[model samples]
Target chain A: MRDFRVLLWLRWRQFSDGLVYWMRVLGYNPKSSGFFEKLYPLYLLIISSFWVFAMWGFGHDNAVNIGSNIHPTSLADLLKAIPPAVLILQVFVIIVALRSTPLKLSFADMSYIAGSPIARSVPVLLGFLRQVIFRLVIIAGFFSLFALVLTRPLAQNIDLSASVRAMLACIPLVVLTWALGWLLGILRLVYPGVSRWNYLWVLPLLILLAATYLPAPFLWPGQALVLLIYGIAPWWVYPFLALLAIGLVVAFVWFGNRINMILAVDESILHARVAALGLLAFRQPNLLLRIRLQSAAAGRKPFLSLPKVYGFQTLATRAALSYLRHPFMLIFSAVWGGVMAQAAVWIISNELPVQLWIGWLLVVGIAPPVGLLHVFRIDVEERFLRQFLLVDGLQLLMADVILPLIATIAGAMVVWLAQGFEPEITSIGALFIPILAILLALCGAVALTNKRVLQTRILATGITFGIIMVVGVNFSPIIAFVAAVLSIMTLGGMVSQNA
Target chain B: MADKSQEDGPLLKVADVSFKYGSLNALSNITLEASPGQLIALVGRNGAGKSTLLKCIAGWTQATSGEVHILGQSIKQNERFVREHVVLVPDTPPFYDELTAFEHLQFNAQVHGWQDWEDEAEELLRKYGLHANRNAFPFAFSRGMRYKLALCMALLIEPKILLLDEPLGPLDPVSADDLWEELNGHRNDGMTILLSSHQLPQEAHPDRYVIMEQGEIIAQGSPDGLRKSLHIEGPLSLDALLRSAIKSRKAVKADA
Candidate 1:
């Protein structure tokens, strides 16, 4: 316990120092800018205030037009519908929860805590506590906000008090899922035998889904369990979930006692960095790949093979090989490009101002979360400017674009084929491809040209390009291609002989 | 008049070069020149602009003011001309983790348009005793090994001027000696090597020692000349001479 307090105090001090650093950077680092840097904090404040007000207005609007009769023919059907949906939601939530496991200590913590005489269990307990706290906050905040926005629609059809209480029940349900997720993750570390048991969380969910249509006597217990909690006993779920959370914490600590500290540390050190960098991954996409390399096994000694091309084409081939050799790297790029298409399509299809909030968040969140436009990071890495300064800036820039271009175009082609059912000259999805090319060009240009705050620049450029692509999707292909060519010329201006 | 632009002039020259990070001058009006075959050791305390000066001359950084001329042409306007002849090995060498040790050298050789650099690459690895793990990623290698790999890459490029920033810090004593011997060989071949470090290597005497304090070169000379300049009454090691020079300048500043 004393060791835990020591660790907590250390974390608090680290957080406080980081706060001061950010305060200096965000407020105005005089060393970074002249007078323009000082105005940023103010600009951020004004924009944030308007955003808050806009969300509240959006919530009010959602509250007004909700569930205006004709959804459910009977109340029992609605009650029963809740259990299965919640069960499936738990599955998705758990998948996201187990992204990575780590002891979550920095180098300083390793020095202090590992050297301390306190029991090994303390660090493990602290790790779990920190993980659980952060995990629950993320899950609860996202889901509860979703529930709050959605409950307004439910209130129109049902009694306001009962509906609010039922909707509020999701918090505890999410809490239960958090507990189960970490308990399973911890059990895997302490007792590898129990790792296989984690796959069973989906069993009851599957049974519940099957029992909805089939008359299976064996699946009734699972179905009844979900229904009783989600539908019948919404009031008492909070205490039950609190008890589950407490029980899980005890299990994690007990499991922590038996786990090897050295093994955990080895497993966790790089992951801790990856987790920390994941927070700012949007702001610094280059950091994501850096950590990925740091954690990756150093035995990757594959010989590089390049084409016999005589000029800048050799660099293009090597850049392409960088994508091909790193396993699943090209796939990740294609997936992010597809996500951009989906988000852009959403923005084009949706008319409501409130829906645009979701669209904007989707667009901004995609950069770090989906790692959209990470192909640009290859140039930022490898001290590339020093490595190939003799190469013409345009060709170097062109080489960097090849992988991102191929991946994004393939992705855009996927979306275009899907939306090609009633393809008109104006409504064709291929029209958006040129606009995506321009956005990608913007991505490469900023990464190659700028040396600081690349995350902010990329985010701003990506979001702006996303908006332009959405608008372009509505225009003729010729106009979009023209915009793309103009943007490509804009790319030339962003580069210099020294760039 | 002999054409200075024809490859017979001073190998490296920084004329009124200055670099500023925001309002702080990292390198302030620093001027230094090195002829071919000169091994110049830049000795200074940390944050003394040694690395920044090297960077400006290497064309890795653009100076805030003034020009760095390599082979009698401004590197600012002629990056290709300078970059072709010079390379800066930063303190921490960067590796593309995706590439193995041999691959890194191969990539550099191929990119630099060297059609057959395999024998040179193999010889450098064997010389560094890294031939055994030539196929491995350098991230797991020791600091000494990483430094050797970086050195190997630079050597293969065979730049006329090699700018090494704090090259001796990560190297072991024996490796350091071996590096100096190789550098000695390079000097014989008329390649200028500029090394920056906070301390001097043991039993290794550079042809010229440039001492910098607070972003400006306070003194530049041979060991005997530095001893005389600082008014050291007797023979002193390079460390003692640098210390005395720093103290003498501080006292002069304080008195003024």
Candidate 2:
């Protein structure tokens, strides 16, 4: 217990160090920092207050009315959806290779924690508990807000006790989900064979997704859980969920104390590095990406030899080969396309208010191209390789654009087929994805060949235009087209001058 | 000042190329040239801008107020010409983490549109002791292995001019010797080399030595010429040449 206290004290110091690291990353040394730079976070906080107020006001006004006897369908329907919601989250956890629970220590942390005479398992178990406790606190903050929103409605309609029960249910629900992820991490240590098959876990998720379309009886446990949340299940259901949550946490902590955590620590370093990259990606993205690629685990080399595709075709083919071998680019591109497809489905269903519909459309519309932030980035640092026979760097840039766009279109095609060949929205999405991708690719290439301090600024402007264009698309197609035309004009001017 | 520029156009020419990184002079008034078949060693300590000089020649970085001409044409104006004819293997290999060593060779060959370089590549892989791990990605390979793979890729191109920044910095003694032999083989076949190193190898027999200090070429000549001119007593090693060059330059700078 004393050792655990020491570890927490160490973690606090590391957390402060992390803050300094981020500040340094954002091109600031605290000693040389300017006055305005010091005020930036406070300025942001002031601006964000308006947004916070708006959201809080809406949540308070609307959520409090849920128990009003005026509407039976919406609240009841929401209650029934709770179990499926949890299942979706669990599926997401599995998809990301159970990385939702980030139990990791940096190399620096290892020197302190591992060097201790305290049993190796004590530090690991304590670390896990510390992570879970922090996450629980954040989760509780969100729940308190939700209770503020929903408590009145349930108090008016169902009863005050039901609202209390519902809020209390959030604790075990969160604990179970996180504990399940931790247990998987422990299992990975115990059974490498089973860990290798983790990718296959996605198949059952797709099946569960399909099953949701069927009758309520088929959902079984999930259906029962939903009823329990709505306070309509057998009385034993509450205790059942509580026992399940507590059991998983106990098992994880107990099992953690037995196994050697060196392997887990080693694996966690990779995850931790990737997570760090994700944070610094917004600043010096290219440099961060280069570092990530350089450090990346070079898996089993693919058997495919370089194809004899000549000219710009060769560049495109090279990218295709990379996608095939690496798979992450293809996977993310497909996910972006899937998101677009789902948005299209929802839009076509005509369920949302006009404002919400347009907002969702813009978000999903801009996603695919943004997902391909590094599409034009050749993983190699040797500039000479590209220009050996390169007529123009733009031709090589075009090649990168084509692969991701094709993947996006292919993803949209899959979802289209899955939607039983609905052509109206999906057809437009397929076309839009490529057009936006080309514009983004053009931006990336222009940034590369046309070296300037304005590289980041131009990208920022393009993103601003994209955000505007998304809203414009719903209001007037003419406006959206004008935005595209203006973007192309800007790109042409930069390229013609720089090239 | 002694005129180091060639009378007739040299194979590769750098004239008064100076670079400043925020007032830190990385390279200052660096003038040198290489004939078609010479093995020139660019010897300097770290921060001496040997890599920067190579980068300027290779067109990886631009010099502040000077131009590099290869075969009597500005490299900036004829990038494709330079890319086809010249290769610069940077200190750290900028390898694609996803591509295997063999794939990197295959990729370079295809870019040059060459179809029959496989045998040459295989020979290179064997010579550098990477034949067994040719299919492995360079990311997992040791520092020397990565360097070898980069060297193999550059050699497969068969460039008229080759620039190696810290050529033997990452390699083991055996690999270094193997590479030196391969480099000599290229030199005999009439390829030019400009390599930088902290200190010349004990076994190295460079045709000419260019000693640099604080971003300027302090002295340049054949190994024997440098020893004779500087009045060195040792067996004319590169280390002896460098020491004499550095001492004379410091005394001259002090006088100035």
Per-model DockQ: 0.30, 0.37
- Over A298-410, each residue of candidate 2 has an lDDT whose tens digit, in order, gives 45446475687655666667777766655667777777777666665544543434444445544543333443535445532346444344445555555655667677767
Kindly list the per-residue Cα lDDT of model 1 for residues A274-338, writing each as its tens digit.
65653376566566666675465444446456565544666777677666666456676666667
CA-based DockQ, model 2: 0.37
Highest lDDT model number: 2
| Residue pairs in clash, model 1 | A66-A153, A283-A455
TM-score of 2: 0.79
The positional error of residue A3 in candidate 1, measured at the CA in angstroms, is 11
- What docking class should model 1 receive? acceptable
Segments of candidate 2 deviating more than 4 angstroms: A1-85, A94-105, A108-121, A133-170, A191-243, A260-263, A272-303, A308-313, A340-375, A379-391, A412-431, A447-499, B1-8
Worst 10 contiguous positions by lDDT, candidate 2 chain A: A62-71
lDDT of 1 at A338: 70
In the range B8-109, model 2's lDDT, one tens digit per residue, is: 578898988999999899999888888888999998777888888998998878899788988877877777677878888888876665567887888778
- B1-256, model 1: which lDDT tens digit per residue? 2145636767788888888999998988888888888889888888989988987888777899988888888876776777688888887887765667887787777778888888999999999888998877787789889988999988988888898998888888878888988888988998899999866556677888888888888888887788787888765566776788799889888999
